[model samples]
Target chain A: MRTFSKHTPLEYAVLYGRFLSLYMRSKMQYKMDTLLTSAAVLIRECVTVVTLYLMLQKFSVINGWDLGQLLFMYSFVFLSYSLCILVFAGVRDFQGIVHQGEFDSYLTKPLNPLFQVISRRSDLMAMLGHGGLGLILFLYAFREAGVEATGMNVLKVVLVLIGGILIQGALLLVPASLTFWLTKSSQVQEVMFYQMRGFIAYPISIYPKIIQWLLTYLLPFAFVNYYPAHYFVGVGSGGDGLAYLTPVVGLVLFGLALLLWRTGINRYKSTGN
Target chain B: MPSICSSLTKFMGYVLSVNIGNMLFNVWTKVAPVLIVSFLAFHLVLPDQAYMIVLFLISLLLGYFVLYGFNLIVWLSAFWFHQTWSFMTIKNAVILLVSGATIPLWFMPAPLEKVFSYLPFKDVYFTPLSIFLGQVPADDIMLTYLTQIGGIAALHISLGSCGARRRRSLSFKEVSESANVQQTYPA
Candidate 1:
């Protein structure tokens, strides 16, 4: 059965694929600079990881969490966040698109703007995020636990990873779509990004009660690593699968976010010349 | 001196106007996390002794103000990437040292915690939360705040001098680029 989309979903997919391929070609056009900057960005991410490890070394535990458990948690969160950034790099740039009147370009193209947005960044970052940190964590966890995590544990970890990515992408949509209302190309985007990072980097247990509630119910950053972490470590089973459902929560939130985005777009449409 | 301070206030207003609303949002994102983490640790980790929570919050804020003040000074100085990283690194270290973000100052040797008490590092992560945790008395709050402000003011002077010196060298475009880079990748 044909969908009600103005541009057939398949047609939009093809167009998006073409756009992404072209975008990559353009990036590759500046091959050396791109390589250098890509490396810089990677190193920056590595520094963040190093901070966590150092914290572990300093006290050997945060709150009550030990090194091994925290490391397991780190692997989950870093791997998940990396995947989200890698796959949804375009989401991060939503502000620029709104500011430059490029959303209009997307609208006129007769595609679901989000699909086009998501698909147009072929996502070298995602591949790196999934495998790069994933391997390191996997090896460490394996060596330390000596087969306690197991194949089934690893598979569940992957599921939790997927959940984390979906929730993260959904979270981006809400703040990103706010550019429609804010109208200024301010540091709000970076601010929110940093806020999320600050909130996510440490154990969720470290936040104030108010913030903990918000992160769990509102932003859902806790689920990215914490829930799945408790599970694989055999400590997560106590009703915390609630954390893994963050992606589902995110999906519903995304639907709501898309509504806001459309409303923002409409506001822009009326305001524009 | 008060007249000079008034002039400085006017100058800062002018600077804020030129920079736009970024400073407000930017400041919130930078400092709010420190507040949140400090407060949370006070409430949760050691809840039985409610008095201790008060002590912890005060201790944490003291540590935070010192580091944040120091950080602003470093940021305003010559644009060295290493210094920028140091600002963040040192700020994190301060938190780790005090308020038990990593290691509790209490767990350390008495002499160490006592030395840290005067050094301003404990002011960042430990003091605010410790005060909130009620580990420290209400009377100590003023002393903590005074010391933190003193540290911050001193560093601000040092940073402002460095910025004043560089004012002649940096062009408008370079200023704009620096601001843009800051907005793009705060991490």
Candidate 2:
């Protein structure tokens, strides 16, 4: 595998943007498929929303949370997800790339293979979904909670949320990078995603001490959604010590993923297809 | 050449038969939609038959329609998920929020409920579960039911056509490539 060549930062940015545009065009090649998939996906996501709505139908408050706060958490979760999809659209095919011997091309490129892989598919549709969900979340917060929409607050929350998304997207590489060593289709990445969705969506305060500790201290999903989100909701700060630690922490984890990836690359036996 | 072709045909058809059988029977039956329908019918309609069977049936129909759409989604997603095994968290969040397997939506925060209402997960449980309880309004619920049932049928035909074509294209490419390799040296 060849190392990515250094380029002027502006030139690299333009190149990356061009790649993104091409990807969007490629995805559009299957216009009907894309539309149907988007509709189907929208319907699928709607099902989840319906379930939560009905639960509220039975009772007014969940664990003392009003509708607005829950919306904040819920929106953040989906919003973070949208960000992950938008940023990491192509990462899902890590194993397939390995199988097809597609990874060989990255070694011959001048840029980081990981960046190339992540940016390969620009999921504009998914990004739109994320934006749609976020809009709904904010709108509801404004209407129900009587919170005034402010530029500063929006900036703070969105910026922090983007940071959260970055961590989540980068974290995806950990399991994806695993494909480097295993070579076969890897499910570890899927398992971890399930973990994030199942455990991280709810308020972690309800969890047992050990499990909460695991999500909070060990995996750091707590920080991804529950912690920094508090600041966004104006419920409270992330806390004194590391309330705002998620962004840096996500970067650190991403760094480790890269290290593991670098180590795994040595073990990669490319068919060079 | 004829003998080789006939035997290969028989062999391939046999493999295809087993696969088709499993897909139609085992996989389809085990999905959440079928289970939801059966359970709703048994628990709501059977138990309440003495009082209001019509209401129960209406409720069951609504629920079944909603779940049917969801099943189609599962069917589609199963392929992507199994193939890629990416985005496990999103799937998990989706199942929990949509399915109502965990927390009931009524107890969730108001803003949360608003978003949840649109999500298909809650729809999976709400239409059937609520209708059985006489919670959903008759007129609106009917619209919901029609959409799901109609959507399922449409989705199935579309996805089947698309998937089949892609597979055929792949095989066609393989055939042409192999033939080209043979022609190059005139073996």
Model 2 lDDT tens row, B19-98: 35644575475565666887885562443434344655565554554544443333334333321112222354475564
Best by lDDT: 1
User: The CA-based lDDT of model 1 is what?
Assistant: 0.61
DockQ of every candidate structure: 0.06, 0.11
Q: For residues A191-251, could you state the per-residue lDDT of candidate 1 as single tens digits? A: 5555665676666776677877877777777777776666556442234557557557657
> What i-RMS does every model get?
8.1, 10.3
Tens-digit lDDT string for candidate 1 (B1-187): 4544454435444433544465456569766876688778665345566656655555554565566555455445324332233233334444454435455576666786677666655656665656665565668767777877776677668767777776544333333333334434222
| Worst 10 contiguous positions by lDDT, candidate 1 chain A | A33-42
Angstrom error at residue B132, model 1: 19
Report, in order, each candidate's fnat.
Answer: 0.00, 0.15
